[model samples]
Target: MSDIVLLNKHQKKALVIELYNQGKTRRQIAETVHMSFKDMADIINEYTGEDKQVNKPEKSKDSRAFELFLQGKQSVEVAIELDMPADKVEELHVQYWRLSKLDNLEILYHEAEYSLSLLLRLHNILKDKRITKDKDISDLIELANWFTRS
Candidate 1:
């Protein structure tokens, strides 16, 4: 099995352009990146500044359903529009919601890591100061404890 590469929007666009430049067909690149052909073409056009006609393929039903849901369409409405089961529309909505939550959590995790590094640097800078003796830095200790417990 091939390992999945997780990329943010900018990175994904860059990758798509790079792959396209390397002579990969749009269909090939789209399938490789798991993006709709229309979306891939749009990215390429945005990057290259060419008014390319986007191929409106019918293969991105899940994405279309999710797009409708995000546009304030209910599950039943999306199902009717997409000619899919309401349950399937609901399932796709839930899946997209979970993925978004995971993305947010990943961002929070990176922020927490950055904060810890900053805290450590600050602690090192203040290590030689007599202020450490006056102030217990109890919050830092508590943070360390929490990390260890987790």
Candidate 2:
């Protein structure tokens, strides 16, 4: 617990990868990493050579969207550039962000980019323990309050 609490983002990912390599179940790894099980499963699936995205008719569009996302383009920008529907691009954006492992970093960037203390608080939340779905929502709501108040 103390070990994980002190680890930075890359260390956490490396730990998750290490756990996966050692044949830990997705649920086990997620608990160890304090991440949501679904997010953990997605990371594991991608790491284990399973295609997270499949059977979409717009395969090339997804690929292009991934490229655009990698270039740091937001979803709206990608949608416009690719002439894609907003809803579809929105879905793709979530997938892309998860696939790219930009989860907490993106949130931190948008929510507290200039505030080291806020960033640390967000970091502490993930670092401390596995958060349940409802608890996660509560923490996010609290964080949003902090953002809005500033």
Best by lDDT: 2
Off by over 4 Å in 2: 1-4, 55-150
Model 1 residue 138 distance off true place after TM-score fit, in angstroms: 88
Candidate 2, residue 72: how far the Cα is off, in Å = 30
Per residue, candidate 1 scores C-alpha lDDT tens digits across 94-147 of: 676666675664454457765867767776876865338534677667778999
Which pairs clash in the backbone of model 1?
Answer: none
> Tens digit of lDDT per residue, candidate 2, span 1-150?
354356677787788889999989877888788888777777677787888566446659889999999999988899899999998997788777778897976565557657968767766886676654777869878998999999
The alpha-carbon lDDT assigned to residue 43 of candidate 2 equals 69
Q: Would you list the C-alpha lDDT of every candidate in the order shown?
A: 0.78, 0.80
Model 2 CA lDDT for position 76: 86
RMSD of each: 20.6, 23.7
Task: Name the lDDT of candidate 2.
Answer: 0.80
